[model samples]
Target chain A: MTDVPESSRTLPKNSGIQEIRLGFTLQHWCLWQSKETPFGEFWPGGEVLPYNGGRADVSFFPMMQSRRLSPLARAVSAVAWHSRQQCGDIPSVFLSSHGESQYYFEILQGMAGGEGVSPSRFSLCVHNAIAGLSSIHNASYQPYLSLAGGTEGMFAAFLEAGGILLETSKVLVVWYEQALPDAYQAYLATSETTFALSMILTRGGGPGHQLRLARRPGKGGSNAEDCTTSLVQTILEGRRSAVCHLEQSIWQWSLDDA
Target chain B: MKNLEAELKQLIIDTLELEGVNPKDIASDAPLFSGGLGLDSIDALELGVALKKKYHIHIDTNSAELANYFASIKTLAGFVVSQQNKSTL
Candidate 1:
């Protein structure tokens, strides 16, 4: 866990602190073994929608199945869906590890083959596509920020969003990641999984929910996908839902039946 | 002429994801925003961006002209056609 700067440690209250609402979407495979199906049992409740060859509309499944979205896109869609469900218009910050991996792989392959990379893929390869898409989706001009760190990606994103909430009244933080495609999966050494979590932070205190800034021990570590899932489960445990931001990860969960 | 209106209506329907709307249902001259179609400000912005990106014509966003541009599918398609013609000329 990196040290949070003293300047960003405290939140300003004059800016109208709002209650944070948290939501999450995860791969069905991850939740199959859990006692409760996180997304299916909660918001947008119903059957577990498949990614490709299924009748139901799996929220973020298309990106994974079609391979159309980069890792960043997966993250962005998660946040966008959550924001649309929550306040309808809130600023967002997205964090990812291997953003646009397939695009980057293709660009590298093109370079190796003496062909230039496609401009479209190049433009979308940046870590901020999620932020850009969120702005477009909400028709909002609010400022957005993006962060990328190796294993510490989620931590960095959480810290930045917490800082923003401290400065403003509210902030939305999103952490998303997808396993790399087969070809580069080995190089990246990540599990073939997809996970997304969103947290809304407000200055005003809320009932049955509190966010504590504390450090327990060595850098909290786990599977990125599982980390996102655990975060959601932890928040959802006590109340219908709450956003939890630990030094390691940020997650939202529902405590009550949805 | 009716077919053209229908085609334009279908385009709007698909583009805007106006659920439960069929091409035959849209009245040609009905207003898109705050009218029969129920499009909102974000839909307007999205439609505007989609038009420019897909059809290669810019739609001005000024308040006075927005009403004229988004009056109906016919109005929007006509505007697009005219912009195409202008670009060619």
Candidate 2:
């Protein structure tokens, strides 16, 4: 079990969701996965509706820029670009458990083998490289954030999006993750399937469903990986609410039709 | 000399992963960076590394003539031949 930090324990539950007007609305979202059937396939839980295809389709970028994006970045760019098409440009919060881990692993391996690092590879190995590339490709100067919040990263991103909503009319939240390298696979538990999900969030009193997030104090048996898929399922299925029992706290999400 | 220039064109395409670009399409005398091919600084560095690894030649990073040598496939082939002769000497 993970130890709850004293500072975090003292922090109020829901992390100021109520203070930020309870919750935000789900304006528009795009979910892209890696290995779905052409006709669309559902997970066993049957909560998430099938996606058309797992491909991201980032041909909008020029070859010079598109060629530089790693496979995961390609997915992220696809969803981010698609979600922002109607809205033009807006600030974004990017979340992932491990960003470009495969690329980082290759860089390390190159060094270990006495081969000098490729300058291009080194430049894109950072956690926020994709975010930076997306901004440059789109020519959008709107502020953006990249975060790796461990097991609660998805939930934490929502809280951050809510905070952004307080200041702006809309915020885009992009969540993407690929499987870690086999070397790190021994311990880290992440989704085997590579996926990226982007959601454009708006403040309360919107036309869409009202998505509320709150926390219940206590530990329960829950895998953080499942929480992410379940959260997406809860939204897509138009289910009322879903509770995720995490190691440190029980995170709950409720969606009310608006 | 012509064969070396052709080889250099293929090397550049392979090293930079310039998909859909063919060696035959690369003009021997055309600029390789910024203006003609539109490659940026990172591609320059990456190409430098690839050249060093393949030709077993040292690149003087601060040399005044470095940019001229990398300016075009024709110039790059000339530099490679010169370096090969010097190594044999």
- Model 2, residue B82: distance off in Å is 2.3
Q: What is residue A213's positional error in candidate 1, in angstroms?
A: 4.4
Here the TM-score of candidate 2's chain B is: 0.94
DockQ of 1: 0.03
Tens-digit lDDT track of model 2 for A221-247: 876666776655544444555667777
Best by DockQ: 2
Q: Provide the clashing-pair count of each candidate structure.
A: 6, 0
User: What are the per-model C-alpha RMSD values against the true structure?
Assistant: 12.1, 5.7
How far off is residue A20 in model 2, in Å?
9.4
Candidate 2 regions off by >4 Å?
A: A1-22, A37-55, A221-226, A232-240
